[model samples]
Target: MKGDYNFFSDKKDDPLDAVCPKLSYQQRLWGFLICSGIGWFLEFCAFISFFQGNGKEFAIIFSIGNLVAIMSTLFLSGPKDQCKKMADKSRLISTIIFFSTLIVTLVLAFATDLTFLTLLMTLVQFCAYVWYVLSFIPFGQRMLKKFFSSCCEFE
Candidate 1:
């Protein structure tokens, strides 16, 4: 629709892409906070659905929440730019793992009646999500590896 925010629209034409910015800092901050909050709530509800034996609901809601939460980062960088960053070398592997697991989790939840597989993939998806986040921090993944290795070292 004409009024809807087409987040993927080109920068110069869109006016929200920082090239010729439209949204003010406060508006962007509010948008981020609100979307993140809604995402968190949906994730929480997904947990309830899981325990209530609604596997498909759990998968859909949880995935939606994850997507919404990630989408909130668009407020920090324009949508296309954010997508580029996700596909960049530093974040690529984790992004692939995260998205693939998300798909696997949903498929297992809906296609097969395999609770174990769906749950396992969902857990894996969450871990991949965290890993993807770590990619954004300088040395975060390296530090985590070092920490784990040091903890495992036994003389």
Candidate 2:
């Protein structure tokens, strides 16, 4: 392939060709696995910190973990495509909310002494991440909507 052929971009060849031309499949997989493992470990630490009542620690560590986990996607798809997909119209709102809440969560944790508010923002950030991730799955957003409506809808 001359690498000019992005004609079938949605197919596998495009990213493999363009993104990390030097990285092999095994390298990408290994990178993802290592990063994901570290991310999960950090999240576990955040969980422990939450239970220990260290709101500051929990907020910072949890945010880092979430970011690292999201970063793992870069190993699977190149950043350009990943970003384009993230900002796709179908998921744009969720992506905006996720990023906005991420910054807000960090700010609440660092700029104020309000531990409880920091905790609340962290929870909101987590929810935003969930909403953002769901956009990647077909019908994920629709299924969640139906489920929420079922619970909230009144006769």
Candidate 3:
């Protein structure tokens, strides 16, 4: 008599399998570097402009803003086990920091001595901030996607 039997049907589901993919080390590193580098460059330009008598107060404020934004972005993007968990939050926080910096600059410009150099530096900083933010969205998305895909593949 032959007995019918089922084999290989006892596999337990893995909790890790259900988790969302995370960014790869290389991708995360690259993204962080790019964001931070741009932030530093913006700050550097602001500092130089301030030394040139281009609204020292405004330049300082804007430079601080850039630094805060960069730090926040890095913190939010740090080695997240789940990328989705922080993506939206990071974007929101960065946006807030960017706008706050703008508001601070405007207030300083009006409240303090608004010189020609100050006006140009402030305007340039604003333009640079906008460009940086806009560029980040796409760059971040691409980098994050690559990171996730690579992570999943690794798994």
Candidate 4:
């Protein structure tokens, strides 16, 4: 060969190649707070309804919260968004919490007559699910970093 030539030669640059900036601290804080608050409120509503002798309403509201939590998580980890990154620790803990809450939810679901307990467990599970999704966000990553740093410093 008179000259070395490669097929993958590209001198042009595309704007689409640029990555989106990570979320700001404020954005993450607001996201975490809003998501957590809405989840908590939804579950609290279900808990109250259960004690009000409105089992039907309780079930409906609880299901709604559960769907919201799961769907939101799916949205966060959605394949379309290639920028989100979750720390290893965050992913591990979230997975553990998710499974643990899932087991408790299932148990409580079958226990019957323990409406209050069931609602409480469901709430916990929803919160865990929310955290799982939040972990992939920049704010969540920062929060986790700070938490681990504090823990290490205390030791």
Which is the leading candidate under TM-score? 2
Give the clashing residue pairs of candidate 4, or none: none
Give a tens-digit lDDT track for model 2, residues 64-150. 998898888777666667788888899999989988888888988889998999999899999999888889989998899999999
What is each predicted model's overall lDDT from 0 to 1?
A: 0.80, 0.83, 0.54, 0.57
Model 1 residue 78 CA deviation (Å) reads 0.8
Candidate 3 lDDT by residue in tens digits, 1-155: 13322121133333342221244556556666776777677677666767777675546656565755555454333423223333456465545555565666666676667566556656765655664465466676457567779888943
- Quote model 2's TM-score: 0.84
- Model 1 earns a TM-score of 0.81
Q: Record all residue pairs in model 2 with backbone atoms less than 3 Å apart, i.e. clashing.
A: none
TM-score of each: 0.81, 0.84, 0.36, 0.42
For 1-155, candidate 1 gives per-residue lDDT tens digits of 23545344443434435442456667778888998999899999999999998877888789889888888888866665777899998899898999999888888877898877787788888888888888999998899889899999999
Candidate 1 at 153: error in angstroms? 2.5
Q: Can you write out model 4's per-residue Cα lDDT over 63-129, one digit (the tens) per residue?
A: 5666444434323222222222332654778757865776676666665777677767777876777
Task: Please tell me which model should have the higher lDDT, number 2 or number 3.
Answer: 2
Better of 1 and 4 by TM-score: 1
Off by over 4 Å in 2: 1-21, 153-155
Better of 2 and 4 by lDDT: 2
In model 2, state the lDDT of residue 2. 47
Question: 2 or 3: which has the higher TM-score?
Answer: 2
Rank ordering of all candidates by TM-score, starting from the highest: 2, 1, 4, 3
